[model samples]
Target: MKKIVISISDEQYEKMDAHIKKGSALNLNNETFSGYGLILNNAEGGFSWLEVDMYTNLDLGDVNWSIEES
Candidate 1:
């Protein structure tokens, strides 16, 4: 699997947190982890899903993720 290190803003994090909690309350085990959840990538934006397992670690290399605030 491709290692995608997404850089999201604090606001985005809060939104995601709430969504995950709601999923848990609804017995959505496939959509929530201990606390973190999965944000899928799709053509038109994506939805939430549970993170099953990480395939690999990301190597930032020369790319800076700090500037990607969204």
Candidate 2:
């Protein structure tokens, strides 16, 4: 597999941090894999979404997947 890095802002980082914690608590953290998803804008600037699961692994390099928000 290939590794690529993507940049996110600080506010997004915080949100993702909270999300992962909640997800792990619920056993819904998808960190055995990494995927890409999209948020779509709707009429009146609303939001819609889509996601794709692209990969899976038993380990995620040197970091713990759930808390590595950045």
Candidate 3:
């Protein structure tokens, strides 16, 4: 198993903050998780993804995912 992190720009962070303030829930879907789940694979100790209240539809042009250094 590997650790990963998502990086976002200040502007995007602000946008997300504002969206949350307005009670807009994060729009997550297949595009965000690729239909993967953590609970389903937890017993096997495999790779999977789980997110809560995070948006999937955004410019995300500068967003990036990277392995977390141990």
Model 2 TM-score is: 0.35
Q: What are the per-residue Cα lDDT tens digits for candidate 2 across 1-70?
A: 4443434456555655555555455454544433333232223433322222123112111211112333
lDDT of 3 by residue, 1-70 (tens): 6676766668766765665543343224232333212111122334333232433432324445557765
The C-alpha lDDT values of all candidates are 0.41, 0.36, 0.43
lDDT of 1 by residue, 1-70 (tens): 3455556556555655565556556555465344333534333334322222122222222221222323
Tell me model 1's lDDT, rounded to 2 decimals: 0.41
- Model 3 error, position 45 (Å): 27
**Best by TM-score, which number?**
3
Q: Give the Å shift of residue 43 in candidate 3.
A: 28
| 10 residues in a row with least lDDT, candidate 3 | 34-43
TM-score of 3: 0.41
Cα lDDT for residue 2, model 2?
A: 45
lDDT of 2 at 50: 21
Backbone clash total, candidate 3: 0
Name every residue pair that clashes in candidate 2. Answer: none
Every model's Cα RMSD, please?
Answer: 11.6, 12.8, 11.0
Candidate 3 lDDT at 45 equals 39
